[model samples]
Target: MSAPVSTGVIPELFRGLFDDAAVFPPGNLPVAEAVPAHRVHRTAWYAEAVGPLLCGAGRLGELAAVPPTSGAVGGAQEAGATPLRVGLVLPGGSAELAPALAAAAPFELAGVELATRDAAEAVAELDRLLPPHVPAAVELPRELLRGDGLDAVLDVLVDSPYRAKFRTGGLVAEAFPDEDELAAFLTGCALRGLPYKCTAGLHNAVRHTDPETGFEHHGFLNVLLAARETDRAAAAAVLAERDGEVLAKAARSLTDRQVTVIRNSFTAFGTCSIAEPLGDLAALGLLSSPDPLPQEDR
Candidate 1:
C-alpha cells in the first residue's frame, strides 16, 4: 500500500463522533474528512449543538429530516455523483418514535443503528412497514459484530431475514471483544467479508496490551496493515504475538503508506483519552491549525 495525501484522506475521514457531539477541538481539518458520510447520523442532541452547519430539515420524530437542498450531501446527487447514503441515529429505546420516524420514510439516511435489543426490533418493524420504498439497513449491536455474532443474533432482528436484515456496517466496542475477542471478530469479518468502524476505545495507533491493565488497545491502524489473505486466524496470531517491535516501528515512523492502509478502512479512531483523536489525525498529517475566527464563530 502507498501513503495517501492529507487532501485525499480528509473528505471521507472528516466526520464528528456523533452529530450532537460538541467536543471537536477548534482546528482545521481537510474539509472532506471533517464532515460525515453521505447519509449522516448523530446522537439526538447533535442538532441542538451544531445544527446550523448540518443541512437537515430538523429532527423529524426521532430522525433528522433533511431536505436535499439543505444538506451537505445532496449536491453530489445533483451532479450525477454516485448516490450517497443518509441515515438517522435511532436512540436505544426509541420504539415509539419508529412509526413517526418511518413516516419520514422512502426518505434518505441508510437505516438506523439501535442502541439496545428493543430498539433493534423497533427499527426492524419499521423496515417492515417501510414498504420497500427505500434501501434499509440495521446496525448490529457490538455483540453481533463480533465472532460468532452472526449466529448469536441469528434469531434477533439484527439478523432478521425481513426488515432488520443486518446491513453491512459494523462497529467494534473494545469492552465486549477485548483485543483477543476483537481479533476473532476481525478474522471472522475477513472470512465472511465484513469490515467495520470501531468506536470509543481505539484512538491509539498500535495494538498494544496495556502493561498495567493487561488489556489491548483496539486500534485498527495495526489491523489494516497486519490483516492478511489468511486473516481468518490472523487476529489471534497478531494480537497474541504482541510484537512490540513491529507495532513500535510502525508508530515511530508513522509513514504515509502505513497511515493510508489504516485510513482505507474508514474505521474510527477513538478513546476515552482525548489525545486519541489528535494523535490519529497527527499520524495522518492532518495537522492542527488554530481557528482564525473567534471561538464563538465555531
Candidate 2:
C-alpha cells in the first residue's frame, strides 16, 4: 500500500531506506520491465521510502540501450524526459568497471557496490575506480576476518568517504551469516564509526526462517535498531530479536537523537520487492495509514 505524505509520524530516519532491486534474484524482472515499475514507485505516495533501481555492472549495455531520460518504459512522459538514477553492482575488482561507468555516464550514477575477497585490494581498486562525487560500498568475504584483512580494510574505510556492506542473506543456506559473525561486523563498524548498508534476505521487517528455503533471514528493523546502539552487547541483543512486536516497540522508542545516529550509521538496504517491506510497515502501524491502497491501486 502507498503511504500518505509524511506528517512527522513515520520516523524521518526511514525515508529512502529501501533501494529497489527488482532486477535481482527471486524477482528477476527484465531491466525494461523493472524500469517502468520503478518509475511508478517513485511517483507513489510512499515513494519517499524507495531509492534507485539497482542494476548489475554486466548489464551496462542493456541499461545504455534504454533512453537515458525516459520518463517510464511505457508512460505518458516523453522518452528521455527524466533521467534514471541507477546503482551499479560490480564484481570485486572487475576490469569492466571503467568501461561500465563510461557506458552508463549519460544517467545519474547513484552509487556502486563491490564484492571482493581481499579487503585491501578492494580498497585500492575503489580508489582507482570510484569518482569522488560517487559513493561506494565494499563487501569483503566474511572469511577475511580470520586474518588482519578485515581490520586493515576497516582502517582504510574509517577515514575514506566510502562505506562497508554486509550480506544479510542469499539463495543458499550458508549465505546467511551466523549471529557471531553479524554481531562482529556490526560491532566493528560501530567501533570504527563506519556507516554501512545491507543486502539480501530482508524481505520482511522481522527475522524469520523462510519455509521455502529453510534459511533464517534477518529483519531490516533489527539491523537498523542494532546500528543505533554503540554497545556491542546491546546491539547484538537487538540483532537477535525475532519478535516483531518487540522490535516495533524498540523502533518506536528511539529518541530523535537515536534515530539520527541510526539512519546515518546504517543507511539504506537493497530489497528485491519494495511492496513486502512497505506492507510490513503498514502491518506494524508505522505508516501514515494502516490501510492505504495497495501499490497496484496507485
Candidate 3:
C-alpha cells in the first residue's frame, strides 16, 4: 500500500517498474523460496525499482504456507515487519476471482491480474466481485488486438475502475507479439489514456533476440519509449529498435515530465528475474550501483 522506497539511485521512470514474478516460468521459482527472496528485494539498495511479489491465485495456499520474514510489504518497516505485499495473478480468468480474493485474505493485496477471452464478462464479474480499493488489470486475448475487439474492451475499461494488461511473451515463440501488433496496442491505449502493464518476454532493458530460443524479445526500455509515442508507426519503430546505446540515450534524455507521462501509460511489468533487468540498467549507465547496505539492514 505504501509507495516503493526510493534511495535516490533509481530514476523516477523505473520506480516500482519490475514486479517480481519468480514463481512464473521460465524461472518458476518455488513459493517458499520466493517469499524470503522478495523480502530481501524490499530491503535491497534498489528497492525503489521493485514492485509486488506476484503469485498465481491457484498458488495462494502455497504462498500462505511460507513463514513470514523480516521485511515490510513495500519497504523496511521500523515498527516490525508486516505481511508481504502481493499481486494475485489469476490466469484462469474472472471465474476464479472470487475464490482468489478469499484465498488471498492473509497477504497485503496490491493488485490483481486476470486473463479473459470475454472482455464484457470479465468487466461485469470485476464490477460484481472485485474490491473497489484493489486495482485490477484485465488481460485481453491477443486475437482481440487484431480486430475491433480491442476497442470494444477498451470502451468498457475506459469508464470502469479496471485497466488493461498485455502479454508480451510466454513459453513459445508465438506468445511474443511482433512490433506492429504491440504498436497498435500501445497507440490504442495512449489514445484512450488507458493505463496498462506488460508480462513475460521483457527479459532485459534493450530489445534483443534470445540466442537460445531465437525469439525476438521486446526490451522494457523499448516499450517505455514506444509508449511515449502516439503514432502507431513511430511506436512500432521504437519497439523494433535493438541498439542499447540508442535506447539508453533516449532514456537518459527524458525530462521528469516525460518520464511521468510515459510511466502513467505503461505502469509496471512482470519480470521473472529482477537481477537481470537491474544489471541491464546499470550496464546502460542509467542506474549507479549503490554503496553496500549497512550490515544491520542486510
Candidate 4:
C-alpha cells in the first residue's frame, strides 16, 4: 500500500514562521491573537507586549519559547521564568554578527538563527566567523532540503573549510524549492542529528492543496516530525516518493493547535496577551478585555 498521507498540518521540515507586527484572527476572545509574535523582535515593546501574559494573568505553561535578546533583557519579573530558549537573529551576509554576539556577556544565548540568501556561502562565513560556543543555523531553501537534494544541499552548507568550527543546525533558505531538493535537505538534517527550524511563508498550517485558489498553509510541523523518527532514506522516500503514510505517521505526533505560551513580548504567546507596554497590538486582533485602549494610541 502507498505510504499514508500527511494531515497537511505540518511541513516536511522546520516551521517557517513569518514576521508580523500584529495579528488579529477576527475573534473577540483573547484566546488567539499575537502581535509581532515572531517578527519585530525589538526590546522597547517587551514590558508592554509580554509582561502581562507571562507575569500578569498566569503562566503560559511549559512550551518552546524563543525570547529575542532585544526584547527580553529588560529584567521583567517573568524574565526568571522557565524558557525553552533565548534566541537572536543575525542578518544574512553579515560578518559582524559573530563579533557582536561575542562582545555581549552574561546572556545565556541558547541558540541563534541567521537569515541568509546563499546557503553555502553563509555557512562558510559563519564557520569562519562564529565563536564555537554559539550554535548557529544557516538558512537554506526549505523546499530544497525537503526533497532528494537534501544531502547535496547540506553537503554544500556544511563540510566547508570552517565546517568543523560550527555544529550542524537546520537549513533555512527562503521559499520552497522542487521536491528533490526539499526532501534531501530535511533528510540530511535528521541524519546529522540537527534540528531544523524554518522562517517566512509558513505563518499558517496547510499545504496549498488548492493552488488555484491561492490558498496555502505552513509546513513546519510536517518537516520536523518526518525528520525525527525516520532515517535519511526513509524521510527522503516519504517526501520524494509522496508516500503519505510515512510522513503522516510522524506528523500526527508533532503538530498541535494549543495556544502558544508567553515568554516575552516578541515571543509567540507573550505578544498575544496585550500586556502592559505592548497592549497596542490588541487593536489589530480585536481585543475585549480590560478597559479599551485610547483611540489615539491605536
Candidate 5:
C-alpha cells in the first residue's frame, strides 16, 4: 500500500477500529513476516485506529520463538522492544485453549475469538474455560439463525459479559451472509446493546462483488455505518449498497456522539491485510495523512 497523502485526520469514531488478521486466510502471511508488519502498524501515524495482532491459539509456539524487535508501540516495556497486544482465535473445542492462554499470559491479552457450536453452548463453555476479566467473543455459525436458536443465543450473550461475533465472509461462497441475514444480526445487536466484532470477507473499504469468485463481500465502512442505524431496514440498505461514495458520505456525516454509539456496538473487524483497509480509508478521505512506513520497514 502506498503512503496516505496529507489530507484529513481519522475521526475519533474509527480509532483502534481494525484488528490485524495477517496470519489468517487470503493474506495467509507466515508468523515471521506478520510480526514485523504488525510492529510497523503499531507505530504508524494512524496507530490509534489499529487493534491487536490476531493469531490462532494453535500457533502460540511458533510466535513465541520470534524475539521482540524495535518499533512496537502501545504497551511495550522498553524502547525498541515490541509490546504485543494479541487476540487468540480458539478452535471449535477448548482442549488447546488452556495451554495457549497460559503461554500468552506474559503478553497483553486483548481478547479471544472462539468457534463454537452455537450461542448457548458457547456462553457456557466461555464461562467454564475463560475468566470473566478476559474479553471473549463467540462466533455462531449462520445456520444457527435459521431456527429460533439465534434469539435465544443473543439473549444469553446480552445478559452475559461476553460479546457476539458474526462471520461476514469466508473462502467459499457459503461463508458470506446475505443482506437480510446480516441486517437482522446487526439490528439484534444494536437493540440489545450487545457489542459485536466481525471477521473474514471484509477485505476493502466499500462493498463490491468479486468478479473471479462472484461472491459479494461486505465493506467495513458499510458495517460501521449500518451499526449506527436503529432502523433494521435502513441498516440493511447500507449493507447492500454498492456505491462507495454514498457509504463515504454517510461515514463522513457522523457526529461524535453518533460515532460513540456506533463504535460501542460495531467494535472492530478482523482483516488479513491491514494495509488494504488503511489504503482504502485514505482514499475515502477518512484517514488523514497516515504516517509513512518507516524507512527501515520499507
Candidate 6:
C-alpha cells in the first residue's frame, strides 16, 4: 500500500522520512509481531511520518508465515485492508532479488535495496529484473568509498534509474563512517544529482557518542543539513555538529524550497526505533506531539 500522505502538524521535511527497521538489528522484532505493530503505526495519528517496513530477502519465508489476521487493528478486517508495504533488502545482492520479488508479491513492494561489489553488474541485473515502477537503491561496497571505484559506480548510477544507498552505522564502531567520508558521499551524490537513502545507527536527530559503546553516531538531522551544503568541508562540519539546539535551529530555519532540495537528495533513512526519532523531533519542537492512543490501543 502507498504510504498515507502527511497532513496537519508534521513538517514537510519529515513526511515518510522514517522507514521502519524493527525486523533488523537490535530490535530484531519477529515478522509476526512487527506486522501488527506496523498496523498500529499505519492507523496512528503520526502515520505520515512512517514509511514501509523493511524485511531482508532471506526472511521472506518467515514473513509469509505470518497469519493473515495478524495485521488487523482497531476493528478493521484484514480482507479489505491495504496490504502491508515493505522494502526488500537484498544483502546477498542481485542474485537473490528475483525470488525475493516473487515472495514479496503478497505485500506492496515499496522498493528494493541491494548491496553489491560490482555496481555495473548490479545495474545490469536491476535493469533486466526490476519492475520499472519499483525503485532500487544500489549499495556501493564500502571499500569503494575511498578510491576510484566510487566514481565508477557513481558514473553507472548517473545513467541508470536506481539511486544509491549508504551504510551510516552498524554493530561495531568501525562500521560508522567518519564525518569526512560521509561528507564525500553526500557531496558525491549531490554532484551527480543521484538521490540516496541511509541505513543503520541513525538512532536520533542529532549527533552524539553512545556512552555504552563509545561509538560516534551520525544524526539524521545532521545528514539532512549536510545534504544542503555544496562544499565538502561545510558538509563535514554539519555532520560533525553535536549541539541539539544548533541543529534544531538550522532545521527550523530551512525554507520550503531548501527543505525540498535537501529531501530530494537525502531521501529517507531506516531507523530501528521509530519512537526515538519521533521523540527527538518533538523535543526539538520540529514536530508536535501526536494524540495519545486509547487505553485499548495503548
Best by lDDT: 3
Alpha-carbon runs more than 4 Å astray in model 2: 1-10, 67-80, 92-94, 146-148, 290-298
Model 5 misplaced regions, further than 4 Å = 1-8, 71-82, 293-298
lDDT of 5 by residue, 1-298 (tens): 1222323365777777889898898878888878778777766676766788898877877776666654343332455443578888986555556787787765577898877776666677678878667899877778886557778778889988888889999999989998888988998889899999999999688889898999999999999989977787998898989888888888888888999999999889998877778778778877667455233221
Q: Rate the local accuracy (lDDT) of all candidates.
A: 0.38, 0.76, 0.85, 0.35, 0.78, 0.84
> What is the TM-score of each predicted model, taking all chains together?
0.46, 0.89, 0.93, 0.42, 0.89, 0.93
Q: Candidate 1: where are CA atoms >4 Å away?
A: 1-6, 9-87, 91-111, 115-149, 152-176, 208-216, 226-232, 239-275, 284-298
Evaluated against the true structure, the overall lDDT of model 2 is 0.76
Regions of model 4 farther than 4 Å from truth: 1-72, 75-86, 102-107, 115-129, 141-153, 156-174, 178-180, 191-194, 203-215, 228-298
Q: Write the per-residue lDDT of candidate 6 for residues 149-238, one digit (tens) a residue.
A: 777778899899988999999999999999999998898888888999999999699999999999999999999999988789999999
Give me the runs in candidate 6 sitting further than 4 Å from their true place. 1-5, 70-79, 293-298
| CA RMSD of each candidate after superposition | 10.0, 3.7, 3.6, 13.9, 4.2, 3.1
Query: 1-298 in candidate 2: lDDT tens per residue?
Result: 1222554434576788899888898778787667777777776667778878888877766765654233343212244454577888886355656877887676677898888776666677778877889988988767775346667778877877788988888888988986666777787788888999889888789888888878988888888888866676787788788899998888888899888888888888999998888888778877665336345311
Predicted candidate 3, C-alpha RMSD: 3.6
Clashing pairs in 6: none
Q: Please write out the lDDT profile of model 4 over residues 1-298, one tens digit for every residue.
A: 0112333332222111212212222111221222223222222222122121111111121111323243332222244432222344454345646554553332334444555556676776667766677665555444444434456655665454221111111122223343344455554554554444444333322232325434332333343333443355554444343333443444434434311110100122111122321232232222233434321111
- Backbone clashes for every candidate come to 18, 2, 0, 42, 3, 0
lDDT per residue for candidate 1 within 203-234, as digits (tens), equals 45555655665655644445544443235455
Worst 10 residues of 2 by lDDT: 68-77
TM-score of model number 5: 0.89
Worst 10 residues of 4 by lDDT: 258-267
- In candidate 4 the C-alpha lDDT for residue 123 amounts to 72
